[model samples]
Target: MSTERRTKVLEVLKTAEVGASLLVKGWVRTKRQNKNVAFIALNDGSTINNLQLVADPNQIAEELLKLVTTGACIAAKGDIVASQGSGQSVEMHVKELEILGEADPEKYPLQPKKHSLEFLREIAYLRPRTNTFGAVYRIRHAMIFAVHKFFNDKEFLNIHTPIITASDAEGAGETFRVTSLDMDNLPKNEEGAIDYKQDFFDKETNLTVSGQLEGELAAMALGQIYTFGPTFRAENSNTTRHLAEFWMIEPEMAFFDADDNADLAEEMLQYLVQYALDNCQDDLKFLHDREVEENKNKKESERPELYLIDRLKFVVDNKFERVTYTDAIDILRNSKPNKKKKFKYLIDAWGADLQSEHERYLVEKHFKKPVILSDYPKDIKAFYMRQNDDGKTVAAMDILFPGIGEIIGGSQREERLDKLEQRMDEMGVPKEELWWYLDTRKFGSAPHSGYGLGFERMILFVTGMTNIRDVIPFPRTPGNAEF
Candidate 1:
């Protein structure tokens, strides 16, 4: 055995130096044998590319070669040489082979065959070894790095908001309660209700649905802050777009208004898209080709207008179309979808909330680019949103993209205490529960705006993948929470 330190397949493949002896260790992706030699495709999760290992049958013992099945882990010492094959540029001539672990051919679920995405989801533990998932996750990581890098470049401080919060920011009342008290025998007060005062936090608490509330507090003190963390929602939605537990990227700026917020969101998204196009070219190409093949089975009308890279380039090159909710409603009402009654929820009036179908129509058909719809009706938005001059609308914006509707949602916050309290009362949100939130407005609050981007939704859009579950490592949905 060579005493040299092991090298990752990516590192070895990128080296221009040849004829150097080295050790490469990874899981077997595929093993094929010809009359005189065996070729083993090895992957170390470093990159989508696998290093080809050539082993002469006379050199490698038969018992050792028998253990080199798919999913088996092995270490090989070899000399780097130029490959004659067209798929890759380099190959390893193995002089020493060691089987670290053996996988039973019949028992290993990930055989050398194309498995459906649904089947891969069933075995998520092993799905990362697959090409589709490998590329997806690498691209996911690249996007995550790009997000932090983007905000860092803008002098934004990264803040960690509380996962457990006492107040609901969105007022949707969809939360998963966190309790240490026994469920069978709960504490009660004289009112004959469960006494939340006896719970873990001395009051009721639940996994936060959004970090925007706390993020605002941080921004008020820090001037500019961004939060990237896990958020939970108790809404039992089992759709391709919804996840019970997922990640959110929220950024709050102290002096930004509604328009400033929209501009920042658009710039950040375009930057990330451009970053992915530059940094994750190989992985994106793999996913793009995969999506193209998958789309072949779909109806002609249901197919994507542009391929993945082209779609991303479209976003990077063009500016997002901006429109008011009223104007959007006018456009939608006069559009063909509404006239033909094709939308599931028809856009009939100004106050009606726009559905996914409506947003897609505006983004994909009307604008042919990203669309930012602002000034939604106040009653349809949260209590904290700043009321517009008209009193019927709030300074809220939702960024809609071609494949995904509302990838981002944000708004200018109510800075005046009285107006905020009045809206809180009108919405039936207890003011006492959010005393800390109101204190910011009472003392030193300024005009602030923020927006939240669902991290998985962004991944889905970038990867051209349709399902949110596939983007996340382990998805927590309505009825499924398996590893």
Candidate 2:
């Protein structure tokens, strides 16, 4: 390794130390020239802003200057001086330059132009070099860091659950099988059926849909824990809000009821939003401007009411409206959407499973604030949820954002062995498959609650991004898994 300490472009642009000798290496974002000098915009993936380098014809070799172009990697030894241009604070007056790598202009895909998001998705590998994706990914990193920081500050231990398991956690039967067996010639049993016993794990296994079950086991002992990792699902729907693979943040807390779970979820989300506001200002500002530009083509009624920053502040500064599922149903039933037959699924009575449209109307139109709907019907919720005394509802809660429906979903788990086993039987979850999970309640269980916040959905809301795919770095949707 070379001992030469190189200054990153972000530090140079941010500090703007005048007359300081600096060696900066980065990819050229844009290049412009005049008869007297050449200006190169360089980025090192440190920030959304680029550092400008001014090269004079007389000081630099003519041939070297000719080789500098967009997408080329270069090293510039220069003096950091105040820029003489607009839209930037500092620039480098280069005394020496070297072209580390040359990108052929003819073959380079990401030229300096206005490329559509669809076009950018086709080139996901190179999309990070663009201004929009750079800002998005930077904000994504900030949010991810904020998640661990918030949980740690709250004394929640981070847990890494197994990615492959023999039992499905979500119990939705939507899982990707994880097998290392030969596909062409599978092993057969005495019944002449494909034998999963010959697989790597010696039993049927799949990618985890959620880490909630394992998280609960840890929480029962650790008091509180959280999981932040990749989660997989086999759902085939190709919608803006769906992803075949994604990252999830699930925090489980022992000795906590449904109310406490809702409070923690609200606080954590507010903290994350505030963290982004403080740490990711430049990137968020860029995405905010990008959102404004993209919203131009949208119909007036479909556009967001507030700017990105204001919307974020609104969530952080206000109290989330907490109401029961029954109350929310009443609100939605009397709302104009239901009366006008505008909702795709009309709310006819209690115990009806709420869809995204209904959730949006409750949070955005009726309440005009973030809403936490709780005490959902047990039939619509998971079998692990604690059944209420009413015999029809469960101690579950879903926090819905204005634009994004159900940003967080969780419940106070059933801690009673008899009740849990009965519900599992009712839900068709085989008791034999989850013997270890049932052992928790059988041995030493306490009231526990947790919720899952889809990491990409939070990023989408924070960045004012319309599509969920835009927030995640190589989105995995149906029939599209390109890198």
Candidate 3:
């Protein structure tokens, strides 16, 4: 049969019509045999839920029955029939089953019980067989599609930025240096500095932390542009939120300011949430139900109280709260929690960068929703951000979700040539290296704004998955790049 002729297990089960001839192929999830009847759960990676397959021992040969083990790939020709079982609404009555591949039940790591996320990470290949990982990855895929759709529908140009770059855009100095050299036989200059002439690129290059710089160049010409690709950072952060490699979505628009940038970020976030909720309800429910079941086994006080469904529903239903950085600082300083002084970092000053803990409190406790904090101190922000009237702060905004601290960070770019030059000089950025960038301002400078949304972070937020490793297919963290 042609590929299109094959029926998806989900489609067959969801339709609920009886006596329809169908051909289904998938890895067998489970198999249970009675005297004459056998039931099997089959999954095709099309959805989180599996399809039920009922086979009669009398009709099918005993040879085929022995081969239908858990994790085995099978192609079954069956009749789509209404299921009388309470577990599912529909099932397939198998006429003949052909085993395409066999999996040794003993070697198969996945069982019909709950497994710790840490344990699952060790066997990344087989982890998707479980319900939670499957749903998370599927939702991740759907969210990617939704993002492309959201931007494409608005006529935003999709720009591809280079993974390897020569300059540090953020200036935080967290970058994975790329080199091709024999460390044992190194070349050095007269001053004992590493010789760049012997390096592959003739100079030091590192993985990009953010695509905003290249994205800005494209936006200047294209009017509206966005970059969606992998970004790397060398920060040795072992926290749940930090990852050495992650995907970032940066959208830049010309003739836009900080407020316009905030509106776009909020709209994009809500759109993705609504899209996933609408398109992947089953997958979301599967993850939710699995989490609830897992949580129930723990002590009442120890159990996770927040519901994924409720959190996502709230995100889609409510308007994101907006506040200036000054306002956020005031609120955090005067709050009862701040008075007790339990947080690690101080939130007493306006110019101080808001730590992750402070951001959590503002979004989770004070706003009770996604909060957009804008207008940050210029010294703490990137050099590209437009300087505000006060000269001390820049027009930068960070959208902090309740569970995920900072989902998006963006700002309005400084367009004035003299101010840009001065900022670069003050930051010690190389003037010769950024000649092309300076020329963009000379040609036709327009006020432009953009933001970078951490893609994996969004998945973590939507799925309520705690670790950054859980959201990505293969996570790359510090000293954990094993494939």
Q: Rate the local accuracy (lDDT) of all candidates.
A: 0.92, 0.90, 0.88
Identify the runs in model 3 with alpha carbons over 4 angstroms from their true place: 1-5, 187-192, 297-306
What is the clash count of model 3? 0
lDDT tens digits, residue span 199-296, model 2: 99999999999999999999999999999999998999788888999999999999999989999999999999999999989988988887788889
Predict model 1's lDDT versus the native: 0.92
Estimate TM-scores for all models: 0.97, 0.97, 0.95
lDDT measured at residue 406 in model 3 versus the true structure, 0 to 100? 89
Better of 2 and 3 by lDDT: 2
Better of 1 and 2 by lDDT: 1
Lowest-lDDT window of 10 residues in candidate 2? 1-10
**lDDT, ranked from best to worst:** 1, 2, 3
* Tens digit of per-residue lDDT, candidate 3, span 101-155: 9988888888777788999999998888887888999899999999999999999
Better of 1 and 3 by lDDT: 1
lDDT of 1 by residue, 191-307 (tens): 999998899888888998999999999999999999999999899787899999999999999999999999999999999999999998888999889889988999999888899
Q: Give the residue spans of candidate 1 off by over 4 A.
A: 1-4, 297-299
Which candidate has the top score in lDDT?
1
